[model samples]
Target: MHRTYSMRQSRAPTASQIENPPPPPSSTKGGRLFGRSNFGHAFRKGTAGAFGPDLAKKLSQLVKMEKNVMRSMELVGRERMEVAQQLSLWGEGCDEDVSDVTDKLGVLIYEIGELEDQFVDRYDQYRVTIKSIRNIEASVQPSRDRKQKITDQIAQLKYKEPNSPRIVVLEQELVRAEAESLVAEAQLSNITREKLKAAFTYQFDALREHCEKTAIIAGYGKHLLELVDDTPVTPGESRPAYDGYEASKAIIQDCEDALTNWVSGHAQVSSKLSTRARTLSQRRKNNASKRGEGVDLAGQDQPMKGDRDSWVAATEHGEIYQHGQDEDEEEEEEEAEGEHEETNGESGGGLSLMQRIGLQSKE
Candidate 1:
């Protein structure tokens, strides 16, 4: 009968043959191999056998679509990796650009800070200057007003009639007012000049002394100290006064007091010098009087005309006469006396009446 052999009776496989079986013949229907010991073949056959031909064809198409989708995913992953690398490079460039910008910003901030400091310093200086200007204006305002008033008074007086009875009195009043105004203006000018000089001198002396001390302390030598020390040294003299800054009113009274004292001291010195000169001139006159005392004007006995002439000649010549009997001396004295008298007459004749009156008044 058509009975198949049993598995044990078919053939006994060798040990190597059992371990490694021969490849099975391929099947054309399902594109699979049969009688294969491989698990891949069984898996495919199971899948194909479980479904019909139409279903298997649809599954195969689905698997092919999955493979295409996986390939596309791989391509997308590669493009993402390239894009990430480009982004990393751009980030590095951006970091460098940010660093440069940060440095520039820091420098700009520093410049702005310095400019702010300068602006503050300049503003303080401007404020001080404006204050000083205000103080100066205040100081001169009263004087300017007085001068304007005096000028108006003088102008009004000038319009009066030339020969009016009140004209002379008005003219005198105007002159006095003008003189007072001039004195006031001069005093103001002197005050301003002196105050300025004092302020400048005070500041200069302080700075110079400071420089001198610094130079000495730093061992810059005595020469540098001397060069920097420009303070004027006056022996046996009072120190000059300083009114302080013009903007300050506190020291103005002290300044005025000092100026008055200084003026008084100057006047005292001038008076002393003038007195000394006058004393010297008086002493000279006294010596001349002593020299003239030797001349005998009131004599009890009258001398002969010839002897009198000789004696007068000797006196006019400013010669001390030794009572000697020499003829040459007497003759020379007589000639000199005649010449002196003639010269005196010529000079006296030339004097005007006013000069003669002045001379008589002095006598």
Candidate 2:
């Protein structure tokens, strides 16, 4: 028996190990949790009939929790995308605001320079007035000295005991001339003082206007900075109504501003057209009253929006009848037809000896 006996068989697992399992189902892949095996089939058979009491409820809860977690992650991803988009819009608005501010600042600088030029001109005028006033004041003494010399000459003549009426009249004329000169000197001094005062006042006014304009420019710059810093982010909602509202608002503002500028430019053009029309109408009435002359005058009065000469033939002269123009046009057409017929005959028929002689003479 000891020489050739087979090894004894091992003992099988107990019924307790097969029935109530020590460990739960595995949570890893490639691990048998439910299948046809000694322990696995027993576990499946035990859990098969218990659907809603304990284990199934736990599995349902776990599935629901997994779905909720996946949904939360999706929401987080969408929120990140929305935030990125809003940031991009905010950055774009900031850039556009900065560009607009830069253009406006350039215009403001040009305006300020123009104002400075005006101020300098006014200051120069004021200085000229001051010089004129000093010069007039200096001349007052010379006029007084001339008057005293005239008085002394008159006294000397009277001391000569000249009872002539001619001498007395001459002295009286000299005295009147001296008195007029003094009066003229006083008037000139007053005029010079007024001119100097007015020039200084104008310079001061120009300076104040320039300062106000500069302050306005500065305020615009500050507003530009604020717009850049406070640029708001647009939401990701597909609100066509909101977008349309903003677009319409922008369009309305643009139209209003355009209308203002157009009115200003139109006013200037109207004034110029009025003056030109008055001058040209008088000239046209003085000149020929032909249809072409009236058309030219009307063209000058009512110029086109951009091209001024397009409607030059629309006006009729006061004295030139439409029938006359039609008759003249018909006569010109008849003459053209006769010339064309003569050319056709000359081309079709052989040239005459006179025509050949004339042609040779021309050549």
What value does the lDDT take at residue 244 in candidate 1?
23
Please list all clashing residue pairs in model 2, or write none if there are none: none
Question: Model 1's lDDT to the true fold?
Answer: 0.32
Model 2, range 125-194, lDDT digits (tens) per residue?
4433443333333334344555667777777777785675656776776777677565645455455567
lDDT of 2: 0.37
In angstroms, the error of model 1 at 229 is 57
The residue pairs that clash in candidate 1, if any, are none
User: What is residue 278's positional error in candidate 1, in angstroms?
Assistant: 50
187-282 in candidate 1: lDDT tens per residue? 444444644465454334323332332232233222222322235668886434432222111122232233223221122212245888999999
Root-mean-square deviation (CA) per prediction = 64.9, 49.5
Error of 2 at 178 (Å): 4.6
Residue-level error in angstroms, candidate 1, position 132: 1.8
| Each prediction's TM-score versus the true structure | 0.21, 0.28
